[model samples]
Target chain A: MKKIIFGIAFIIFFSFLIVSAINMRTFGEPTYSEMDDYFIENAQSETGANNVVTSVVFDYRGFDTLGEATVLFTAVVGVVALFRGVKK
Target chain B: MIGNLPYVAVVIFVGLGIYTLMFKKNLIKIAIGVVLIENGVNLFLITLGYRKGAIAPIYTYAPSGQAMVLPTPQALTLTSIVIGIATTALILSVAMMIYKHYGTLDTDEVRRLKG
Candidate 1:
C-alpha cells in the first residue's frame, strides 16, 4: 500500500515537472537580461570589483548578505541553546 | 526547449529528496533530503542564467566584446549555499538534542518521547 501510494505520487509529480520543462524556454538564451548587462557594464567601474558576482553579493546586495549572516547567527544561538543544558 | 533538458537533473534531485523525506525514518536522513532539495533549487537557478559563448562574470578576463554569465543567480546561489549550511547545522543540532533526550534517532521512536 505504501509503495502503491508512493508510485502514484511520483508519477504525478514527475509528469508535472516534465510538462513544465517542455513549456519552458530554451537554455542559455534567456529572454530577460537587462539587469545582467547593467551589472556587467557597471560592476567594475561602480564597485571596483573585477568579479561581478562578488560585487553583486558584497556591494549591490550587501544588505541581503547581512540578513543571511544574522540568520546564521540566530541558528547558531538556537542550536547552542537547545544543547546547552546537556553535557557529559 | 531541448537545451533546457539539463533540468532533468533538478527533477531527479527533488524526487530523491521527497522520497527520502517521505520514506526515511531517520531524522538525519530527512535533513539530508532537505539539503538535497535546496541544492537542486540552486542548480535550477544557476542553469537559468546560462548563456551561449559567455565568459565568467569577471572583468579581468572577459573578451573585449562578449557576453558574461549572469551574476545575480550566482550571487543568489552563494547566498543559498550559506543559508543551507546554517539550516543543516541547526537541523542536525536539533537531531542531536532529540537523540540525547530520547536515546534514539528514529523519527517514530522520537515522537514517542515523553516529557
Candidate 2:
C-alpha cells in the first residue's frame, strides 16, 4: 500500500520536475530583481542597518510583519481556548 | 540544473509531505506533513533569493563590488517559518483536544460529535 502512495507521488513529482526543468529560470541567477537591487543599495542609507534583509523585514515591510504577528497571536488564542479544559 | 540541488531537496520534501498527508491515519502525522510542506516552501524561497558567488545581505567591511543575495524572499521566509511553528503547535493541541473528547485518536472513531 505504501508503494502505491510512493508511486503516485513519484509520478506527480516527476511531472513537476519536468515542467520546472523546462520552464525554470537559470540556476543561481534570479531575474526580475530590480527591486532587490534598489533595496540592497539603499537599505543601508535608509534604515541604518548593515543587514539589508533585517532592514527590509523590520522597516520596509513592517505591516506584513505586523499581520504575521497578529496571525500567530490568533492561533495561540485559539489553541489555548481549545485546550483550556485539559487540566480541569 | 546541477547547481540547483536545493530544489531537488524541496521537491523531495514536498512529495514526502503529500505522501504522509494522504496515507497517515494519525493526526500528529498529518501535522508533521503540514510542517514538512512549510519547510519545503521556505527552502524554495531561500533558494530563489540565492545567487552564485554572492554574499549575504549584510555588509560591514565587504566591498561594494561583491554581489549580494536577494533579501526580500529571505525576509518573507523568516515570517513564514514563525507562522509555521505557530500553526503546527495549534494543530497538535487541537488534535489533542479531539483525542480527549472522543476517547480515541483515530479520525474515523471521532466522527460523531455527541461523544
Candidate 3:
C-alpha cells in the first residue's frame, strides 16, 4: 500500500519535472545575461587576467571560495574526530 | 523539444538521484544519490551558460573576434564542486560510523536499532 502511494507520487513529480524540462527556453541562447556580459567586458581591464573564469572564481567571487575551503576543512575535522577511537 | 535535451538530461539525473535516495536500502547508495544530485546541479549550471559558437572566457592572445561563454556560472560551478566534495566526504564518514555502531548498512535495520 505504501509502496503504491509512493510510486504514484514519484511518477507525478517526475512528470512535472519532465514537462518543465521540455518547455524550458531554447538552448544556446540565454535570456538574461547582462551580468555575465559585464564580467566578460571588464574582467580583463580590472583583473588583468587572461582567463575571465579564473578571475571570477579567485577575485570576483573569492568569498564563495573561502567558504568552500572552510567547509572542506570542517568536514576533514569531523571525519578525523569520528574515526579517532579506531586504531590501525 | 529536442532543443531542450540538455535540460531534460539534467532533470533525469536529478530524478534518478531522488529515486535512489528514496528506494535504496543501503547507506552507501544514499550517499551515492546525494552525489548524483550534486553532479546534476553542476551540469545544470554549466549548461545554463553555454553559448553557441562562443569561445572560452579567456583573454589570451588568440581568437580576437569571437564571443565568450558566461564566466559566472562556471565560477559558481567550481565552488559547488568543492562543496560537493566536502559533503560527500562527510556523508560517507557518517555512514561508516553508522555501520560501525549498528553492524549493518540497511536503513530499516539501522532505524530499528536506534536507541
Candidate 4:
C-alpha cells in the first residue's frame, strides 16, 4: 500500500517536471542576461583577470567561495572524525 | 524538441535520482541518488546561462565579435560541484559507520535493529 502510494506520487511529480522542461525557453537563448553582460564587459578591466568566469568566482564572489570552502573543510573533518579508530 | 534536449536531460537525471532515493534500500545507493540530483542541478545551472554563438568568457585575445556565456552560473556551478563532493564524502562515511555498527546496509534491517 505504501509503495503504491509512493509510486503514484513519483509518477505525478516526474510528469510535471517533464512538461516544464519541454516548455522551457529556447536552449541557447537566455531571456535576461544584463548582469552577465556587465560582468563580461568590465570583469577584465576591474579585476585584471583574463578569464571572466575565474574573476567572478574568485574576486566578485569571494565571500561565497570562502563559505563554500568552509563547508568543504567541515565535511572533510566530519568524514575523518567518523572514520577515526575504525582501521584497527 | 531538439533545442530543449538539455532541459529534458536534466529532468531525466533528477527523476532517476529521486527514483533511486525512494526505491533503493541500500544506503550506498541512496548516497548515489543524492549525487545524481546534485549533478542534475549543476547541469541545469549551466544550461541556463547559454548564449547563441557565444565563446568562453575570457578577455585574453578573445574573438573580435563573439558573445560570452554567463559567468555567474559557471561560478555557482563550480561552488556547487565542490559542495556536492563534500556531501557525497560525508554521506558515504556515515553509511560506512552504519554498516560497521549494524553489519548490514539494508535500510529495513537497520531500522529493525535500532536499539
> TM-score, chain A, per candidate?
0.81, 0.75, 0.89, 0.90
lDDT digits (tens) for residues A1-88 of candidate 1? 9879988998898778877767777878889999988998899899999999999999999998898889889888988888786678
Scanning candidate 2 chain B in windows of ten residues, the lowest lDDT window is B106-115
Which of the CAPRI classes, incorrect, acceptable, medium or high, describes model 1? medium
DockQ of each: 0.72, 0.58, 0.84, 0.87
User: What is the DockQ (computed on Cα atoms) for candidate 2?
Assistant: 0.58
Candidate 4, residue B73: the lDDT equals: 94
lDDT of 1 at A48: 94
lDDT of each: 0.87, 0.85, 0.91, 0.93
The list of candidate 3 runs beyond 4 A from truth reads B112-115
Q: For candidate 3, what is the DockQ-based docking class?
A: high
TM, every model: 0.90, 0.87, 0.94, 0.94
lDDT of 1 by residue, B5-98 (tens): 7787777788788888988999999999999999888998898888989989987856868789899999988888889999999999988878
Q: In lDDT terms, which candidate is top? A: 4
Q: Write the per-residue lDDT of candidate 2 for residues A1-88, one digit (tens) a residue.
A: 8678777867887679646744667668997899999999999999999989989999998988998998899998998888676685
